[model samples]
Target: MAPKEEATNAKNVATQHSQEEQLLHQLPKPNIQNSKYTKRAVLKTLLNRDDGGFALVGERVVVGGWVKSSKETRVPIFRSFLKLFGVGGGGNGGKDSPLSFGQRVQQQPVFSTVTLQVSDGSCVASLQVIVDSTLAPPGRIMPSGTCILVEGVIQQATTSGKHTIELKAEKVLHLGVVEDHEKYPLSKKRLPLHTLRNWAHFRPRTTTVASMARIRHELTHGTHTFFQNNGFLYVQVPIITTTDSDEFSNKFQVTTLLSNKATEEETSTKASGVSLESIKASLKEKINRIEELKRTDSNREALLAAVQDHKKTNELALELEAEEKREKAKANALIKPDRLNFLDDFFSCQAFLTVSGRLHLESYACALGNVYSFGPRFKASTSQSTRHVSEMWTVEAEMAFAELEEAMNCATDLLKHLCKWVMQHCHEDMKFVLKRVDQNIALRLQSVQSTEFEKISYYKAIDVLKQVKDKNFTTNVEWGVPLTEEHESYLADEVYKKPVIIYDHPKEVKPFYVRQNDDGKTVAAFDVIVPKVGAVIRGSQNEERIKMLNIRIEEQGLSKDQYEWYLDLRRYGTAKHAGFSLNFDLVVLMATGISDIRDVIPFQRSFGKINN
Candidate 1:
């Protein structure tokens, strides 16, 4: 090819590239963070602008955020002059722009300005803000965590940096100065997650926690989308329920009994000033006086008068004693009528924070055909493990006219949908997690979404565990025993390298609600164990036979009277139903590759650990 022809082709390529850039800026963009309700543009909107915020130059906008870092710099006189004229450096335009280059110099000895990196927790990116010291003092807005709302014009960055555009503050609309910079919890550059947990109220400002928040929001949205699209009604179950859904009994009892008892005890203490013993002593003294009168051969009238006084004192003592007994009885009324009775409680019956919503959701599914409940469930477990939190959100779904196979399919589909949703919609946060939390998080999620999970029975799983000649598990495997976390990890992480569904667990280990298998030794229950996080989902086919359910309830030593309402569904119109419950926190843990379940939640409530 000749030189002229080659040059012409290069010129055409350059022209095409220029046109594409122009078209990119002209395309319609999403209204992500800028809205009339917001009254200002968020950092996410400016940072994630379609044209990398370059087209936003010369546009005046208001922004509010906390200062992540602040620096004051001095500029030379010649550079200042060039910036004022908008000739040498990058500026929005000429004098029409809102001080795009720098602020007009006054009587100050040196040309100084403060540049702040501000973030609003909307996204991981922070906007660079240039504020003239005259509008807001450097000392006031210099510290990290100092909040400010400012009106500024977007301008091309004077110096090349991560951000394409910078905000030139024309007016400081609001300034929330940090009083004690040294004492601020977020002032430090880096803090461990455990340390941040202590300052949970302010931890959202951190990049890790902020990213986790976005991940959680997207996961929650994805959950609702999956269920709603699959014709599942979003039914709400009671958080404080009258019966325990599981046999563990690790339930936080919701009652006013303790307070009521305290109040009654206080009233009883205040009611009686004199002791029963003191009254008896007074009666005895009066009787002794009567006896002395009689022994000394005093007048009959005097002796009779003394005897009458003694009788009156004895009657007073008896009245006092009776009042004390009544007070004791009133105090005893606050105690349980029997072992499980809570008659004196606020609800007049035993109530606890629900451990699972499957039972309640089953009732809804029986009527609604398909239903789901998503809310926080509480456990009074004392385990201080990273995975065990006192409060965790669970997503439980029940399907009517469905068996164990359908339930397993539903669980698998839901997990896959969530994984794909997070990968697509929460790309930014997932990237952050990949960088900070786990290196292989994206790959793990993709594998889970695409791979077909392996299913095995309880006996098979036990056999596989026992056959592992090279690996020794902490908990020994047995035929009728529940699989521990160690055993689950080996199956998912070592053997399959993916999720595994273990079904037909031993009846002795499962709850009474599970349908008894034909063998009579195992129940139609399944647990979905994933790598890193074991048993994220637990599901089973419910027992539809009233007699079998009653016997199981009795076998577990649970009161049939308490579960009579649950039995009514089977007695009236029984239908085979199956359901599964997924721990939302555990799902998040798997998605983000965060080892500790506590970190995934906004404010985790764990054993002996509760903070704001």
Candidate 2:
């Protein structure tokens, strides 16, 4: 063991270590974030590792991806800078170079194929071309949501380690003119989820968004098949309804009266023997009282003095009148249907986008034995972050003759089935998206296929979260608080690192229909959470006894008449039924590791923006 021989061996070891790191980066990192992680950046990061490995930066090479950066000069005149060198200005014969893709095109052409010839002069010539849709034509195209095809040879630059090739445009074919581009406000760029909210139409084109949407679609089908195979009947729940089943005091009112135009008298005038003349008299008296107040205000010395001093009181009044008239005109623009009043005219039958399909699904579950409701649900909650949304898809399943444990088992099996099915179908998209999806698709499918998810009550979950190290949480875990995202994330990501079913939430936190456990303080509720995504699935064993359901309704202080049909489900033939809800958006986020709820759904419909 000579010193010289030992030094040589150490140097060889270091070299080999660097080579291994390069290979690791080149191979896909599964279950990682989907966007903002470019291959080159990942490769560079891996190569620059300081972990005393073989420095293999120069050995490995990246082949291709869409050009994230173009090498265009910042000089006011790019041609002039090139001319300073030995090269001629534009073309070999002094012809002008073609305009870059950023230039706006009047109309995108419509054709079967577009050929882009990336020759020696432009940036496209020195890079791999990604042919995608655009808003306009190829030449001088501003790259607005435009679609195109690319064909070119893969070339490399010897001096720099990075890949540099020319994309020769063989043809530029415009598909069609975007008549209302603003209406379809999507662009060909990577935007933050918050910014993408403004461009709902185009957001789905991004790799993360496209992948999430596809995953969600696959999960939806998986859910339906899982229930169908399990002998559960698929139920179509009613969207427009008079029933306030949960009686949460959040149901949007469905009335025929014009909310703005209908007078208070018209709304409350259900007199036993009152005449129309009496109603008119009461309305006139109220108007007169308002007029009297207005005159009194006008006569006030302070108001009169201020108006006189300002000398714009009359003008201000006139302006106010005009503004009020304009508002009224806008309000009255739409004519009310003969059968419908103003409120109903403005919005058809205050029938809301449902929050969940469980209530209506219960009716079918009672009649059909086992039933599940799967559809888009709307919620008006203002909480906005990585998790919550104003509108989302929910899966609510009801089972007759099923208990809480049975419900929990159903949820676990359904989740495993969904994960398995998605991995089997979405392999290509998974490879295309690369890392950032935070999933080892094969491993997840394999693990879920063989393993049963852990079932723990809410109290157990709280204990698990308490023991989790370095877990940052906003809300303290008490006996009855709803599980916060931090608690859920920690439980799923750190403690379990697998699917964890949390059941028996407090009745105070759960909705009215949730069956009361023997402890009275808790309800038979469950939520299936996994690593990276919080609250992917939620469900409850429903209170089916008419007396108990009515007591729940009374305890929640809801009007019984509003939910008579819901009661009828229990009255006719009630059974011990249990169900669970699957947050399809969360499923997509969990499946793809997409952080934003907006990007998870195609044609996102949520607060601030609703894309048609």
Candidate 3:
């Protein structure tokens, strides 16, 4: 080598050696004595800090849960919700753009990160931090969701009037490792909630679900304290029940029979062809007679009308002929009609799951003088929306000798108490969640506490809705029409822009148990709508007089047999009572500012997704 070249190489080597020595000196010094701050306490302290930006953007935040997902095929988290949370598509002016759909679509919030850690104990030792392959260093399996300590900074994020903040990790310290790692259903690539139904066990590891669950916990605690302090008894209602409280057909039939027994019953019924015979008998009796009546009608004026009537009559006659033929064929086959012996049925008796606890609490109100039932309610309605759930926890309270006015006052006080307690006790949890999921949750709760809810009658709300020119809703919401979600949301989120209580609904739309007002047009029912949660509380004053209750049951054409006990409540000790069923999830959804209901419930039983 040339003299000059050799001299330069030696100089560079010395410089490199000095740099290595400096790096060694800068290595982090571990604290020898481990402090005793529990995970809970540390989390609280992190949240209690008013400078949330420090922990999220500067100070490291090490969140360790479980392996919710891995880097295998999982794309960047941003890719999953880009269209929903992204920028740049705004006013691009495409004629067919989503913005032109008359409603502004919510954009999914974006987050940026540097490191993600996944680990197992033996092969992958503790303290291994994974880096992004494209941008930074090669990724490593430190541990996914496994408990780790990380150092990071917190920063505020804002876009499109919405605000959020998150922790940006500098260095991650992987503590211990967990084995037998299970693949969490929530992956970096977003999947529809229905797809994640089977893996509800791991949904909480997802940021959205975790935030929701925490909010749910906080709301539940708030509700308990709200009633406990308000002199309302916290009554635990039964789960497996026989009474159809809601009187809605959306009840799941409880059956204890094994699959084999069901098969046997099916086979026996098929062999006898009893279902076919029953259909044949009904068809034979009704079709021809109705057809003859239509043919004999004298109101027909036009030849076209006469021909149309003849066509209908012939079709019915043919249907009756077919039914008779079927009956004869069944008799020739020597198969007797099958009888449904309820006693012999392997499934035995079927009972309904409680739809709403309000009625049961009403019963208690009559017996115990004043009572409340707070428990989980089951609904079989298949509505796959942002706010519907099959199984939900509810707080239903009944007050004896209370009128509609008194009921409204109680609901307001209860709500205020709930908001106060959640703000007080759940400050830390709420703070942590706000940092992780929603930034405006505290502000929402603060508003609830600070502002007095506006109260309006149902008729006034309709007048407000009628003024809205957007979408021209065809449901024709007059003073007596049922309140659709759109109208309710507009009242709470748009017009009032706060929690609202809408009362005095038309009796035709309300249930029979509701007390009819002196006007004889509307019932004493009220629905409380929170800003974002929509309809959160539904309640009404009960018809206390036994004679009135019985008349209502008959007027509504409800089977008096199914309501013996409900009637007994009035016959024994009737009082002018009022009650409300507070949808607990909705409370949390509002308190936490969560946009979706699926996030609030752990292992949620949503529509079109049944667990095996």
**TM-scores of the models, in the order given:** 0.80, 0.60, 0.61
Residue 230 miss distance in model 2 (angstroms): 2.6
CA deviation > 4 Å runs, candidate 3: 1-141, 145-198, 256-350, 432-436
Q: Is candidate 2 or candidate 3 better by lDDT?
A: 3
Angstrom error of the Cα, residue 349, model 3: value is 5.5
Tens-digit per-residue lDDT, 195-272, candidate 1: 888988898999998998898899999999999999999999989888767886477767777656646465443465
| Residue pairs whose backbone atoms clash in candidate 1 | none
The C-alpha local distance difference test score for the whole of candidate 1 amounts to 0.86
lDDT of each: 0.86, 0.60, 0.64
lDDT of 3 by residue, 1-612 (tens): 999999999999889768754653564422222125633113323333454322233334454323333333233344435456663356655665545432333343323333332221111111222333332222333335545555444343322222233434455454444453346334335655545556777565554555556556666777777677767776777776767666644876553433334444443435755454455565555555455556775454544554565566556556656665664555434221143333543435446678877777776676676677777888887887688888888888899889888888888877777777777766555775687667888887778778889999998998888888875775777866788877888889888989999999998788888988889888899998888778888899988877777887888888888788888887876678898888887787777666777766676786776564
State the lDDT at 131 in candidate 3.
33
Comparison by lDDT, 1 against 3, better one: 1
Model 2 TM-score on a 0 to 1 scale: 0.60
Superposed model 1: Cα runs more than 4 Å off: 1-33, 75-111, 266-341
Task: Give one digit per residue, the lDDT tens place, for model 2 in 1-612.
Answer: 999999999999889768865775685533312126432222223222342112332332222222222222122233333445644423433234333321222144432212222211111112333232232233333234333333232222222333332233333333333455445445344567777766666555555665666666678888888988999887888665645544443544444454445343332223344444554455555555545656774557655455453444344445545655665565545543454543444454335556677888877777788888877776666565767776677788888899888888888888778778887877655664446555465565566567767788888987877765675578877777788888887877777777778888889888888888888789888888777777877778888778877888888887777688887877776788888888877777666656677767666654566657
User: What's the lDDT of the predicted structure labeled candidate 2?
Assistant: 0.60
For model 2, give the 10-residue run with minimal summed lDDT: 117-126
